[model samples]
Target: MCVSCAWGKPAKPHPLEFCENGAKATSWEVTNRRADRAFFAAHTLTELETWPDHDLEEQGRLTHPMRWDAETDKYVPVNWQDAFEEIGRELRAMPPEKVDFYTSGRASLETAYMYQLFARIFGSNHLPDSSNMCHESTSVALPESIGASIGTAILSDFQNCDCIFYLAQNVGTSSPRMLHDLQDAVSRGVKIVTFNPLHEPGLQHFVNPQMPGQMLTGKDTPISSEYYQVKNGGDIAALFGVCKALIEADDALKASGTSKVAGTDAIPDDPSDAGTVAFAAAMAAADKKHVLDHDFIRQHTAGFEEFAAAARKYDWAELERVSGLTRAQMQQAASTYANSNAVLMVYGMGLTQHVMGVQNVHMVVNLALLRGNIGKPGANICAVRGHSNVQGQRTVGITEKPGLVPLDKLATLYQFQPPEWIGHTTVETCKAILQGEARAFVSLGGNFLRAIPETVAMENAWRNLRLTVQIATKLNRSHVIHGEIAYVLPCLGRIEIDEQATGPQAVSVESSVAHFHGSRGRAKPASPELLSEPAIIAGMARATLTKGVVPWDRWVDDYSTIRDAIEQTYPETFKDFNKRMFHPGGIPRPLPARERKWVTRNGKANFITPDRLFPEFSLGAQSDDVLHLATLRSNDQFNTTIYGFSDRYRGVEGTRRVVFVNTADIARLGFSNGEAVDLVTAIDPETERRVSGFTIMAYDLPEGCCCAYYPEANPLFPLDHHDTKAKTPSYKLLPVRLVRSGVAPAH
Candidate 1:
């Protein structure tokens, strides 16, 4: 069972706790493996470096502190004191800004807070983190539209919504727990509409492995009521098309004298509507049953007029061509959503990991605002995060670019002058390293080398660094890509308990829905030699900083003191952090939107509109014989960490070198199923930007779109190609030409 599943409740056991995906996560974490000094001794650094990612991880878990010996190019065992002292000396010598503190979602909140505090105390704001790569776009865009950066809806809202609009995300494979919610919603007659390029099986049918009957019979549970395979990067066009259809539908209703606009409440406190007649008058502006949240639009937001004008100016026909969805499908989704009492819209990396990722998020927010779906139960926007504690990491200050509140509060709480300037984000950090501006890199968790785009370049940058420290659970690619002085410190995994000078420590985590909960580990420590993240950080801070520079030892010995410090900093949110976290389910932070209290400067929810319908990046000229490849994971994969190679739903066998291309595209390109081909990306003409020797497989995907596994094809992605506003790599839109290995051009 997953850690959050059946283990949480005693009486009412969750039926989907033991799903195949959860089993994979658990097995991978609690594997019977140990990669100690002996294992490292057996294999030379060069030999280990030559091994594939899976083979190295499968070798075993690390059991001792290891330091890279540059002479031998191997990791030699060292005492914890020597490793910490060496790292401390490096940090003490360099300017704080020269060193970047990076963290992964797997790190504990205590560790994350301490890491940020230590960096600030040491006089650097360089805290490039994993979030910058994935959901930084969401964090950047959502705050502008809504008062908060997080999703407006909670998980419980799923049970109350009448209709659910799911876009771009494959919930079954990415988050198996989400399927249970979808199935529950379907059973309650919640009309589910899915927009994706391929028909995901989880959106079709999901059989709970925990359900004895379903598991034995192999019967599947239904998920979506209707599914539409929109073209890649076509979400914006589809949204505009649906909104246009909605406008048309409203006009038709008005002509028939059956419009609901007549009875709805007034557009609260809209001065633009001042001296204007009624709610019907404002409704008449759009000729729709619901207009945008006028009060929310006017005060707390900007660019309403521009957004409304763009919505009014968009043409259905143009949207249809761009989206590749029929006018009927667009009309159906719009009408279904408009008529439903409460509708919830959900999106994931599919929409966010684009060059126009922020704009894409704004469009989704625009759709929700038009129907007044936000700030109400069962009707809001949901951004499904990839990492387990990603939301919590952001909450606890694992950020390179800190917000005004976080920086200001941190300065006051820690008694240090925090840097006013925005630090380097993930993309910026990579650029800094390449430019020789950043010298050292410290990662709390996550394989930075494998996770980031432009793999070869990032590795080269890592090699140039002065020192690289990785506090990890097991060996990954990042460990082998050593700097001049590299240290690999094994830390306790999420499933393992952290025992310190005080007692068992508890860490807090914020879920996707903005609910904060306590995550206490029950499993034993992987090894006695391993140190908790907090202790490791505390030791480093003590070694680097002079005495009384900060209270590092006090917080490290007792983690509750850290929570108390967090409470002091964010009193409103975490008034009684320690006491409240003691509750079975930690308290939900106060979101102004939850109570319809907008915290914007205008103190109202605002409608923000962009001058353009979609960003320029989304609109591109179609290249002949070139397919836009979107890299994705199979049911067996999790981010960059692959559990196995078998994708059961795709019906693929033991290999990741398979490409999912449409049959028509295959015919047009003159490629057959299982034909070996080179998918050359249209990125860097000088360099060979192609993933060679991939078996072409025909799948039920849309035309002008193809699919392949990531990190493998990540080489094809250019380093500079990213979202202009958010800097998230456009993994979804890689224009490339496919060719047979030895065959000449058809021309």
Candidate 2:
């Protein structure tokens, strides 16, 4: 997290220009062009559905509470009291299982805490959130592997690392702020190796604007020392290949008289040669030292024998076929890891958005474990979060599974018995709504309709809801796709001033690095009608839970009370919340794995063994015709918010409907560059899912892999295509065929 995600005082705030389209939206939101009660009344659901997502949002900030009028086929203004009372009545009319409480990642810690608390008090555990879509695999696998849900390394590890394994992260488009960290690390002689389907410019080099010299000279610093385009969903195989190579090299070295390979067959086997300048120079000339941290592995880890045997059993041919990379490339990566003092394996959605998402993370941890990299200063798994405060939301107990959190402490402190059973995930929520089991859908913030898969199917099922509530700052696709009786309550954005009963209040956000810092909005609210997220939640809680024991109003008045309660609930992690929150850099939660202390059932980091070497998609799609689609995001996009039609990084200038494929695949599939193609998935003959009119652009990707932008390509994803362990939607792994769109390409 950067300045926007923390408590900081800059002459000018970071959100103004650095946070993608945040600054531009902030400027337009304060203008008179916004959606009021009248705007809603004038528009019908059919009309709103026709509006582009950008235009729907450009209708500006939602200035009043609105409810859908079935008779008029429009949303009419409703006062906060009536809206809250109506929502409460509807909720009370049905069992807690009928409602789904969903939250976006951008909400503050206080708001998330109260939101989850309200759901539990209302006797519902169905709290599906954005994390369920993105990094839920990390949440599921990390604890099993290392006994922690967070990455082992913090921010400082980047600077101290000797090498970094960059996997599937397109830094330029997604998070440019991280480019500075990568730039700093690379400039210090740290070797960065990247593995991705697309050759992202951020992974290649970066021209830091913050550094005046580089900007003045228009020079870019080279980043990755080597790059490998591993096939989609083949990251586990790629990593396994490297691990096998490392193990074999070490075995051969110790088995023979070779102490250090040093790139020569006649090298000496002296033990004292490790530190000598001549020997060190000779070692530096080679790719690897052919050594392993056996002591660290034996003392602090478990299941090594089983894991290694599984990895070694897979021959080079199978690994090469699955990974779509040469054996030499994997060996080179292993050599870099072997020679490095500390290696950081950084991965993004490329690894997590798969059928084997949890196993993908497990393999990354296993790779680090092979060399005893975890719990060290500059080495470990770095599961980069897509959003800023997503981890924080989960940290404050926003989860469907009650066992994943400290619910016992919460029940003890709040004096309310929460549901113990696991609730619906995102996919389950969609299914429940389709089957008429889910009566209502409540979202704190985010464009849930546009972000989810099977847009058409969900749009049809959305109307089945008895009620839908959107607590948001602006209009979105979700707002327009209204339930039978819908309410849109405007809330203050992060940049807006949140004036509370006491005074202007601040809310703390926990960054991905586990650092907790307060965020106080300084800009004026887009409208005077706007309410803070805490205030809106408090209103919902007050109206719903009349006999509630918790003091919602008091907490809303001063958020420090919420923080105080949070500290009491999570005494170990959030101890002295208020005091440490506004402190200089913020307090960090103590992760057990950070100190080589695994909090697993066996009290040691376990090497997870997969029953198979490759993912189901890779195994099933053996031929080049059944191409695997890895959905991507445009450079001009932030989640579902499309800022512009241009994606300068990917070389697309004026359109979002385009697909990139390798020349070999384009030819093999009987398609050519600039050909309009319809990418369709045939799960069954009766059902056809197609994203039509996509122009084919030839790019460097694996033969069986093609790239298309997300949300647009979301329809091709099967609803059931998800990680079994985490239930995370496998956005990356999709088998689709290409057919001529029979439409002319836009010139």
Candidate 3:
């Protein structure tokens, strides 16, 4: 029986809630597992490193504070004061710019806010967060395209939508709660079109494990109205194809001298001709409507005209060729959307994890604006985030490159001159480490070593650090890979209540739709030894800083004071932050686009021309035999962490080492299903890096495209293979080749 079953009746009393993954999170936290000093004493760091990620975590959660002993090569137990003093000494001794402070979504708003405050007070803006890896493209592209980085729609909007166009995002595994919304929408006659490379179970049928009747009968709810297995990196082309088809249809109508279709009375009599004219008109309107603060853009942004010009040139054939989507299919998508009362375009890492990811987001926004889908009810762009509070972290100053406004606000709030120098992004931080420019790294949360791309290089860079501090809940690959002086500080998990010196603290979290709500943990702490992240950060700040720049103790003692600080700092949106959080659903920040008020200088949204018609990938002069490989997550996994070996949705069982390849490509490459091959990537002419050996599986994937699990295939990705604007790794694009060994090719 599962842990939930053991409790007779589950404690969760909320209606319209709970999925398998949610249950897993709850159970994992409530489990009778503990990893303390004795466990570390029993096992050496080398021995622990040899264990599988799951086994090590399953051993029990880390329950005590640990400090790395260089000679012993193991994390030994240390008191809280000792750990803080040591870390404080190292951090205070180093130059502020030489230290990199990183944050993960797992950190609470109180913790995240304190972390940023500490870093700013220390006079360094070196805060590189997990957002850089995931949705930086959304952050980079959406604001320029629609005058906002977040979606204009709320969860309730899905209920009234006529159509939902889901691109690249897997609803079931990524955000299971979205499945409930999708199901409800489908039941209400909403058309859902899913475009992905693999046929995900969430897009097919999802059986609510929590529904007793459904669980007992093994019944499943139908999901997608239409599923399109689009080729990888083909979303932009697919979008353009849809737009072109709409344009062509409009052109044909105009040529025939038909104002409207005989059967369709919905279209206006003077409906403008489609094709280039309609696209151009839409682009023009958006540009006139959306403009960034011109001063900020001129001062902060580079390459504006180049991007605008690229948007002006749109060719259907070229788009079709690039996207691998049929013009007819595109037309269908566009027509369906245009005819629909309301449409929502939802996406995830699939669209953003590419070389042209930023451009891809721009295209998606262009489509939304063409039909005036944004800022209205039941219509918007939904970037289904991977983690719960990832979006919130960014909103509260977790960025490395915080604009002048945020920095200035901090200075006024604390009476200290914050650093004006631009901080390092994730990729830059790695480069800094490799170049020995950065001396120390402090991670609020997250398995940095495993989550980052080019794991081998990242590990080496991590080792070069003088001091590394990880505030985490459990033991992961990151804890094992240590700097010269390392500390593993166990922090309170989300499931555990964070009672500070004052009272039970509630931290704010930003949901996917940009709604901010307070998340108060209901469960007891895993251990009394575990300290809240905010408390730990405050303790470090108190011990490290020579001068008290801000009232760190007040904020740490009571989280409400932190809210007060955030409200004062970002008064524009976070007004009455403390009072509003008490609302049942919480309040949403004022998105200027929601009211069609673009924050741009012209007070209008702008159309940015793409730099290139199509993204180009050259993995060291690709050989004829080489194939481009894309790294992806299995259904059973979330980001870099794997829950199990089986990928139930993809039909892979008991394995994480298998690679999916198109049958035609496998045949052409003289390979067969189950054939083991060495996957080599051309990082450079002199260095041919081997990613990993995998047994090939002939899957119904697009020809010229292949995919394998991430981190495992991360070795194939060079450090430099990333989006130019977002600095996100091109995990969806890689140039590689297969080499057969020992056995003959399948007959």
Candidate 4:
């Protein structure tokens, strides 16, 4: 319901009206791709490891529990009891600190609750999930700034918002349904301002495929009212420019007091005028409104004076240089923000996957707070998430820090001391595994190895592990890249029935828009051999834990009891879990921020002052020869899963191996428009990484910035290149050099 960018409640009537992007691709998954007991017996792990991502997943749904057979070099089928027994024995032999439990966004709230409970009771708080890779910045920043990790806007907020500031999200490939929201907003005359290195086509124009007349007549609806190509990793400076312009306009409005004569925001009429003069003349034509919410600042906020003073200190020239946008452009964008009664600040991974990811979110929240946007009808921060249930997983206790969780309640419930030590995140998990500190890896579905950076080194480290266990629905690269004692345990998919002792059971999933949805599988199970994710975790917990404090068998039989347990752990959020959330359109999980109740340390919304004008490695620090490489998802991809080889929005048809660069950069670097080249990163000279033979395509991004599809380009960046506070990798602004295909490497 969440990740594919579909509405929390999907549209209907016409097939094209289904706003979920991955629906059609997901429907193609039938028995044809099923990897039965025989399929596992047929292919060796080595043979499967050689296959590409698209080809590998096409092998179909995994049918049974299979253990790595070193003697035969193939996966051999094993019974459930024996498999759990073996895994439990190995885990029991090692310290719990040496085991890492990672989860994907696909798991349900019930499953995630059970998974983390098991990890905590086992004397380790080492729980990390898909949130670490994507919105960890949001998870960390929002709470510190506004007292809630989740954003304040609901799905309906899009309908009410007067203006939308859409930043760095390529909705064409990532979430097509979000375009429907923008289109609906546009139909209502809402102003949409977009900022990104490459201005995607969907943000420019869209002819609805559902409306035959529009498609046949070639009548298109424009989405973005104004588009700005903000440089990669330059969002903070760009935001500063807009903030500077807005504060200056407010200062002028306060000084003038409705008398508009030579004010800071006003301009005189001039005949035969240039574009800047025309814009100024248009602004001078109307009476200006005070931009900042003075009353809201006085009553509900702290640190405004300090934040405003810092904004006033920034020079226009420096903002122009760092943000790659002129003062005029910044003022125009700021004018749009100030004029609108309500503005929704929207952002995506382009803002998060950076060294200043947390700061980037803080700035977005600060901008929203300046105009009193939080807790309003159509004004708030919207951190668009990537995977389906990723946010929900975090809501149910999948995290590296256990301090955020109610430790005393859990300890009393289980009658055991909970592990309070900070856990290893995705980046630390890899380092621990490489250093031989972590011996076991348990994942709740995800192509972890392929999706991470430093693919070669990670794969080698993965193979050296003592044990690796994957609870999944389908075959992927992780299944093939087996550890010494790897076990692939097949589980029920979200689309299949998960029957238990309490009749057909439904698992609750939290959507990105704060809705708690009950996802029930109508279809039959993929195979009789498949077990539910909660059942699998329960089985492992029963075999491993000697105290047997939890009723693992009963929890597996009745998932509703699991919900009750979750409510007990997180009473404020998950209270009345069974009664409130299991219906047609699920009830919204309460957002304290939406009510203007800041749960921060000082009990007021805090306006943070960023220490530096330019975040992370600034534009001037790197040479012109170096380019910022951003990894992205194609049209046919969902997260790390590739459905096909097509990205129709950008005109790619048969290949995924391509790099997008500025048209001038190709000439500046002595390369043709479509020439093949090797991407090399010499950031870490000792561990210089390279990916060879990628076709170069001239695109509309700024110079010194390049783009490439993910997974294929994952190896180009090192493991240590990440945001320190959030631990999110710098996938968006990796500095690299494009050399000719046959040239020698940098290091």
Maximum-lDDT candidate: 4
Put down candidate 2 lDDT per residue, 1-747, tens digits, no spaces: 232222122223234225443344445445557788778868897798888887887777788888888888788888888998989888888799889999988889999999999999999999999889988999999999999997766777887889999988887777666676788798899999999988888789888766679989989999999999899878888998888766666655544554543322222233233322232333435744445677777888888878777766677889999998888888778877888889988888887888889999998899998888898889977777766578789989899999877878777777888889899999899889878899999999988888888788988999889899999877888987888789999998776778988999998787667778787888788778788899899888888874448989899899999999888888899988888787765677789898999999999998897677665443232344678888898877777777678988889988889989999988887789999889887443346678898999999888888889888899887677889989888888787778888532221
Where is model 4 more than 4 Å wrong at Cα? 1-7, 10-17, 28-31, 257-285, 615-622, 745-747
The C-alpha RMSD in Å for every predicted model, in order, reads 5.1, 4.7, 6.4, 3.4
Please provide, for model 1 over 431-472, each residue's C-alpha lDDT reduced to its tens digit, 9 standing for 90 to 100.
Answer: 888888898998888888887877777787888999999998
Which consecutive 10 residues in model 4 have the weakest lDDT in total? 262-271
- Tens digits of lDDT, candidate 4, 365-470: 8788788988888888788887778888888889889888888988888888888999988889988977878889999989999777778898888888899999
With a 3 Å backbone cut-off (N, CA, C), the pairs that clash in candidate 1 are 35-60, 35-61, 296-605, 296-606, 297-606, 297-607
> What RMSD value applies to candidate 4?
3.4
Decide which is better by lDDT, 1 or 3. 1
Model 3 regions lying over 4 Å from their true place: 1-16, 210-219, 259-317, 619-624, 741-747
* Overall local distance difference test of candidate 4: 0.82
lDDT of each: 0.75, 0.80, 0.73, 0.82
**TM-score-based ranking:** 4, 2, 1, 3
Output the number of the TM-score-best candidate: 4
Off by over 4 Å in 1: 1-16, 255-305, 601-604, 610-622, 684-686, 742-747
Better of 1 and 3 by TM-score: 1
